[model samples]
Target: MPDAIDVSATPSDLTLVQDEQQRTKSRELSRAPFEAPPAIPGYDLLHRLGEGSFGAVWLAREKRTGKQVAIKFYTRGQGVDWSLLSREVEKLAVLYTSRNIVGLLDVGWDHEPPYFVMEYLENGSLASRLKEGPLSASHAVRITRSVAEALVHAHGAGILHCDLKPANVLIDGNMDARLGDFGQSRLVTEMSPALGTLYFMAPEQARLDGIPDARWDVYALGALLFHMLTGAPPFRTPEAEAKLAQARTIEERLVVYQQVLEASPAPTAHRTQSGVDWRLADIVDRCLERDPQKRVANAQIVLDMLEARDNARAKRPLMVVGALGPVLFLVALYWIASTVGPRIVRTAEHELLQQALAGDAVSARILASSIETEVRIRQDELVDTADWTYVRQMIRDSHQRTKDELSQLNKGNFPDAELQLAFDKVTNHIKVLEQRLAQADRTLDESWFICDAQGRQIYRFPDAGKSLSESFHWRDYFHGRGEELDESVPHDKVSPRTKTGVSLAYLSTSSSKYKVSFATPVWDEDQKTVLGVMARGVHITDLLDQWEPQIGKEGRPDDRFLSLLETRGNRPHLLDHLRIEEALKRVGTQERGEVILRVSPAVEKALETTDRLEDYRDPIAQLDPKFDGPWLAAFYPVGNTGWTAVVQERRNLTLEPLGQMQGVLTRGALSAFLVFSVLLGVLWYFLHRASL
Candidate 1:
């Protein structure tokens, strides 16, 4: 270049420099002043609604149509390119006829800053509603249904609302929902990187490389529903990046949504509206299901379920009233019988039989004048001869005499026979005197008569002389082979008897005399089979008189001692003083028949060790050989009889103590009602202020 510059090379280098300068000048000219698109003549911009990274929305009024519209301006200087504006405008135009989608009314390329006008909505967006608080279940369902319907339509139209979220849904004055912002929407046929709000994007979308599908809209809808119900979007944390990482897994996103639902309080509208059912809550839950496949396939299914729920709720009040009416009537009848019926029967028995028997001159006067007088005189004579003090001193003296005699008998290897004889004489005398005193004090009353198993009258007491032949029969001792004597049969129809001729049945012997009999079976020493029965027959008049005093003034039947008797013979007699035999007889059948199991091994062992065994309370009821009912019975081996004593009551009646506790519960319920009323008043006042 210094040596007169190779002329050809110099010329080529100058041409290259001119071409580079021309290209720089062209770029500068392209970047120079672009006037904002001339506002379509008469159209006027009012106020800005929002501004974003790519565009700004301005409320505008159309001069010709006199219509309000949202003009979205995409200024190249404001970080938007021509391509993005054109794509968004095209998507909006395509979705114009969709009821769920916002429509593009017009576009202006005449403006330096290209813009498009969309139909204006006044009620703002779902995101704004969520910011106030969670929506009620019904409102949440309604919004979700609309959004899903729009997604279904979009998906069918070969489009995906890749950026679906609460912010993209607009509510109008009538609360009608519409979707907006198709800026990020893509044709389903396109293969592109995922682009959407991180929190609302499905796991597949969060991957940044997967193809989007209808499920993408499903996941976004779930996220939006979660926000509407919980007042916060799922996976939205203060640490944005960390929260976005968690949203990558479908399971993790679902867990977040579930946690929000569990933590959220039930809606206030539900608490205030008594007629509103809880089934609406189920719809919200279904929409928010983590698995896109599990959610209603589309909005139609959700709408169908909601309609069904509404119909069910409408019928509930009438159904409840119909069911409760019959229950209340039955309860009233039971209460009357349980409380008042027993008292009436007890009063009738006392008035008719008890008073008459106690005042009867023939029976009472005979006992007072003859038998009782004889017993008292004999007792006095025995005491005069050997008072208790004298008897005690004599016993001690005889003990010493016997000991001396025994020592004398043992003096040699074989004691004197005479000394042994002397000791035996003193012991025999003492035994005889003891027997005399026991007999004198017996003082048997004539109110009832006693008999042996053989139907033999045993020293006829005053009432015992009524009859020994007709009243005391062989059938009375041995439960015979009558139709009522079947072991599998219930005592409802069968009268039980003891071998002692104590008839559980009311036997009409003489014209005005009725007897109530109680019997105990007499068994052999081995206690295997019953040999006879020991019976006590009381004049019905006298027995009723005795029971009257024990019956309290409350006038209820005394259910405590239910006297029953059964025989141990081949036929096995059964009897019940409570007169429940009629009911049992009516219920007689194989299915309802009684069953008897032998005593347990443990119980048999206990019996062997003790002569008199008393099990006051048995946990398990022993079935009668001929009756069914849980009975608390006492078995006593009377002489040689296989006899037992039974007393029973219904199980529910045993819970009398629990019934008394209802008063405390009633008071607690009253207190809770008062508290709830006060809380309701406070809530109403606050809600009124909130509405204002």
Candidate 2:
């Protein structure tokens, strides 16, 4: 049977609430006693299926055919609008042949209580099924599409179901939609007004003078779909219902309805529902657009869109594969040819460079150890000379002389002949030691000097011809390994002497070259008291001269070089002899001749705390902006000498093979891509011609 208007349906407005209460009152008055069954020729009345204010629907069976049907009896003069009934019957008659519409049988207009018969759909209405919960997206969309197809057929017949809702949509025995309840139906050409259910009604249709429009049905369809998917009509909230009840007049209620829908946030629950996607969501959103101009034009277009959506879903997998095929193939090519191949070459090249750098670091360590040994030997020579019996006796005999005689000798006065003769013997012994030290190593050109206990230099090699003119008190070698060795301390404060001390590197006053002194304290025979200090100096150039032949050797590239840095004072200073010599040769002795060269800040930062080799940029490389360095370098500290040895090599030579391999990989990828494209093009050309 066609669905009865659900008396249980929630009322929308203050007027509808009063109308529903009145209908409830009338239903009680017209139950079976007040309402009489009209006798028909071949049908027997079964029972009252449902009742409304104007009429009641009863279940009946044709006696001869034994077929069930629903009869809606319009009670005469019970506020029945005969024109509305006429319009509804006319619309149904036009859509009689449509399978999606409920079949209308017979109508008796002149009967005491006029009635009409409709096919009995035993499964009831969509609204009854929806009371359980929201339907799944698949089920909901399927039902929505079926209803839309019915609308398309109706619209073609110039009919609009203005009151479309779940209750109006009947589910037949086969569970297929059969649109019915066209009480508010209008022909497309009619200007008469129709108001659908609240929240489902379009804003334009809520106006008192609203005219019939197809978009009104579009909005109802969206609301119907939304209800199926989310279990409630969009904007039909408890709060909205309460506000709607507050409106006293039908005009006020209609205005409030429009306001509630327009002001509320658009419905989005369907978007997050289990099986809903953007495509379906978009269709519902378009149909529900508040502005009719923006809404989907008609139900036919809605049906067409739904069909397209279904077609798209069916073809999605094929489309995905077709779109992603080339991208996946290119990714494979990059993995095999570009990434793995070049990475292998780079990794192998990196390992080889590390091995070579490690070997270089070892070589630097060896050179540093050799320098330490040589310095130690020189210190031992000085200690041995200081321990000489004749040298100690001469110092003792000189100290024994009167203070007046010592002062007079220093002032060049021969106050005592014996003291003068003792000074001469000490001077002669110093000259002999100086000659022996010079012959021992030709690099030792700086004079060896002897300082008395008072820190006065009484003798110098080759004799500067001045007696006791210089004081050696403010020297790090003179003091011990403590803070006083800085050479900035007062000369009067004598520090405890070291066994053997190497002074900080300083520029030679005479030769204008960097030199360092090795000193040992001379002692009395009992070794209880220090008599004086004896020291010899060697030029930095002489110390680094050992590397002269090693620099730029046959296998050593010119870009690779070694350097020495004095790791004392405020910052590390370059003491490389090769660098100093080059500068000297360029300037020809006009420069101050300081061996140390300050490095760039970047290089100094790298050298600040590192004690081992690492990748290094040549400090001087920044002098020329064009140099791309990234040199591999090793730094080894020369033992206890306050100097670091550096061995550096250009990195490009080591990575040259890797660079070539990368180039080959890049070219190969491009070539493979081009060939693949060409092959595809040729294959497509042949296939095209074959199809023709």
Candidate 3:
């Protein structure tokens, strides 16, 4: 989910056909006769589209009608009962006219390997489309619905598409689906169906011995939907497959298969982390139910659920608008202009100010909640990537080699080229890591550097511009002022919770920006003794910048009204603030270290009070011409961090509303504004929920 599988970013084998060169390469598995076409009596074989284990399917022209069509040659004629082929022909005849399915145009029983001519679809298979990465939610839903409809038709016709995967779902010129490749299909009356593609295969189907039912396709539907949303199939690992393949007996195979079934790799945790629509994820979960009896009754049930979810999402905004009407109506009729009109206006103005104050609190809460979510998400990314086997190995290999080189240098054996080569590998490895981090769902990712076990710097993104002997043994992260903790002695942590021990810091030697720097030890596979420390940080200023367009919407060009995070450290510190305003510029101009405040009434009041909005003057705000003392402030805590999103505005500027003339037009505007606050409250509720 972090790395969205968008249509333009195909991954590995899921890559779609982009050019003739790729098409040629894809046919590396194509076993279709290159020199001579299958001897179909009337149809002239054109070019091969693709081939499978059983036979090759080709594009051909009908001599009688001069119409382009696909011809499939069933080459394995040695032991396949001719009568089973005859039964398949009969089934195909019935399915040829079904909607959302590949149409069968004609059949030939007299060729060297019997051939059948079907209509040609040029676009390609779903596998090829997925090569472009994961489809969008709408496209995924539509495609699944269409395929479910096709499954319904096949199930009704007493035929089972035993193998249902992206490769079998073909697309035509219009991007409409056509369920093709019925090579593994069997009549529904069979006691047991053939094994389908393992990734999409239902658990019971792994036994290849069950009374055929519609639930088989139901499971496949879920797997297909999962693939579309998540890009990769759940638990589709070569290692798992190879283990099953290597099992020597039915008992051994069943044990391994049952393990896989119990794993039930659908609806992965990563999928949940992706923030996909819950309704869609639920549909996939239902389809992937491990117990066949507990799964959705049929493909039709899944389709019905999908459509219902879509309808509900479509009506959400309208539902929200309607729900706000009653509250607004009550506020609009609070009082009329008459004997008590002046008092009424005053009270209304009071309520309006209260609402504006509430709005400030809401805005701050939104920003805080969003930041908290970002922190948790980024931490998750850091942990997941840091724990990856290949990543750990790469880091260890580079660091271990560097340590060995340093040891040799200490013994006075100068292996200059070898040492340079070792450093070069470390540098190159860091470069690769940085590139991957760039592609990952990182926030800012200012720099990623690593230190060897001896506290010497090994790698930095900009190459550190320093010699390999440079050590960070005195830094706070490595050694700090704690007599009990032992400054020179070291310890390490490797897991998720441990990797997220981020401390605040300012960027650059000039301290022009702020960031959250996390230093966690990289360990061997067993997570024992530390091999090295990998440090990652992102400039928190970039977070403020990202919210600029939204935050600046209601404020002036100079950004008089702005939001920032304040942390209650030894004293209050502006953890991350935009430097666009005067007060911030005056306080945050330090060339080194962070700006930590000892005393500020505005900040203290906001942190202590539960009130949505309040007013206070900073003691330091009046010292300079550029600074403003009085502030219209709003505050809220961020996910138990003792950090708050604080929005501060120049006091006089925000009080303009109270200074407006008491006139008919002015009254109307105030009334309208109050009424709109009800609607705004509703909008905020939804937005906050979405952010969470």
Query: Could you tell me the TM-score of candidate 1?
Result: 0.37
TM-score of 3: 0.42
Which prediction has more favorable TM-score, 2 or 3? Answer: 2
What is the number of residue pairs that collide in model 3? Answer: 4
Q: Highest lDDT, which number? A: 2
Among the numbered candidates, top TM-score falls to 2
Would you give me the overall lDDT of model 2?
A: 0.71
Ranking by TM-score: 2, 3, 1
Worst ten in a row by lDDT for model 2: 13-22
- Residue lDDT tens for model 1, 1-692: 00011112211111111123443553454355333334656688877676533445777898988888877766543333455457667777777778888777888866767777888888877766666788876687678777777776776576777777767888877897888877677775455544565456664455444555555666677677667767766655455434424653434433443454345443233323322356755654555554443444444445556676878878788666634454443444456457654564445433323222221211222222232233234334333322223222222222233333423322322244544453344334434544664575432222322223333332222332335322143434234322223334433333323223233334334422334344444444455544333333444333333323222113334323333223343222233333333333444343222222234444445444532222222222233233333222233332222333233233223334344544554476457456555665676788799999
The residue-level lDDT of candidate 1 at 176 comes to: 76
**lDDT per residue, candidate 3, 1-692, as tens digits?**
00011223222222211233534443443434433454576777777665543356677888898888877766644334465455546666878768788887777787677877767777777877887788877788888988999887887676777667887787888888878756556664454346555567777776634444566678888888888877777666776777776765444565676687686445564256454688888888888888763477666567668777978898888656645674554344454333456685676566545544544554565566666766666556555555655445444544545544544443334456654554455445556655675575334567666666655655555534443445555443333221112335443421112234455444444235556555666667787766556676666666556544444524363333455554534545555544423344555455323333323645565567564544544433433434445566677676644566776555555546555645655578568667667667887799899999
TM-score pick, better of 1 and 3: 3
Question: For model 2, how does the per-residue alpha-carbon lDDT over 1-692 read when each residue is reduced to its tens digit?
Answer: 32344656666611121234545565565564437567866789888877655577788898889999888887633554477556666778889999998889988778768888888888878888888999999888888988898898998776788888887888888888889878788765555577777877988898776757778899989999999999998888888889888986667888999899888999898888998888899999999999764577678667767877898899888657644465555566768675686666766776657655654554466567656777877788778878876566556655555545555564446556765665566566666765785786535547776677766665566434443445557665666552225445565677437477777776666776777888898988787988888788778778766554443434553555667777766556666634564454444445543332565556667776664444565544433332345777777887787888877766787577677877886898799788767766776788799999
- CA-lDDT, candidates in order: 0.47, 0.71, 0.59
Report each candidate's C-alpha RMSD, comma-separated, in the order given. Answer: 38.6, 39.2, 22.5
Model 3 bad stretches (over 4 Å): 1-35, 38-41, 83-88, 248-255, 264-266, 269-275, 327-692
